[model samples]
Structure formats: structure tokens, C-alpha cells
Target: MVQVKLFDCEHEQDLEEEINRFLSDLEHKQVVDIKYNIAALREAEDEQIYCFSAMVMYIK
Candidate 1:
């Protein structure tokens, strides 16, 4: 069956690390694709918050 896993982080590197770790623990054949997205939101006049996320599509 097809399944999806979501991973989110404030930093891109951290998100990559987490996804890599999880991918390494699973068989490569199980993973179909990965979608990555980034967005920035204004928290204040001079502050911004960044969101890094990934969607892992795999076969369960």
C-alpha cells in the first residue's frame, strides 16, 4: 500500500538529516518520491520564521 510521512523543521539541514536517517533505515525500493517545501512568515517587523518541510511517499 502507498503511505506518506511528513517531516518538518525550522532549519533545512535538520529536515534533510531527519529524512536521510529515516530513509536509511528503510529499503530504498519502498520510497517512491519526496516532496520538499519552504515558507517564510513574518513574526514581527524585523523577525521572520522559516518553515522547512518534506513529504515522503513510500510503499508500506
Candidate 2:
């Protein structure tokens, strides 16, 4: 199994799109049983700042 995480302040849609792109690339490389999640979002130290986190997994 493999795991990956992505963090950004952008919207979930954008993040999901990026993650999908990544998964597509991995699929092209013959990776299988992949899973992913947008686990959390929270405010950063700065009030105007935001944080996003995602997790990805796959089985070799």
C-alpha cells in the first residue's frame, strides 16, 4: 500500500481535480486499488489563511 497527502487553501473542487489528475497518472503507470480523501480543512494562524489536507492510498 502507498499513501499520499496534499495540502492547499484552495477550494475542494480544485483539490479534488488535482488529485484526480494525479490518480490518472498513477493509473497510467499501472497502479491499482487506489483510494483518496479530503480529510480536513482548517484555519491557519492568519485569519485570512486556510489549510486543506488530503490523503491518497494504493496497493501495489
lDDT of each: 0.94, 0.55
Candidate number of the best lDDT? 1
Residue pairs with clashing backbones, model 1: none
lDDT of 2 by residue, 1-60 (tens): 555544453576777787678777665544534344443434576445334446555544
- Estimate candidate 1's RMSD in Å: 0.9
Q: Which stretches of candidate 2 lie over 4 Å from their true place?
A: 1-3, 28-51
Which runs of model 1 end up more than 4 angstroms from their true locations?
none
Cα error, residue 50 of model 2, in Å, equals 5.7
Candidate 1, residue 48: Cα displacement in angstroms equals 1.2
Report the number of the highest-TM-score candidate: 1
Clashes of each: 0, 0
lDDT of 2 at 3: 53
Candidate 1 lDDT, tens digit per residue, 1-60? 999999999998999899999898779899999999999999868799999999999998
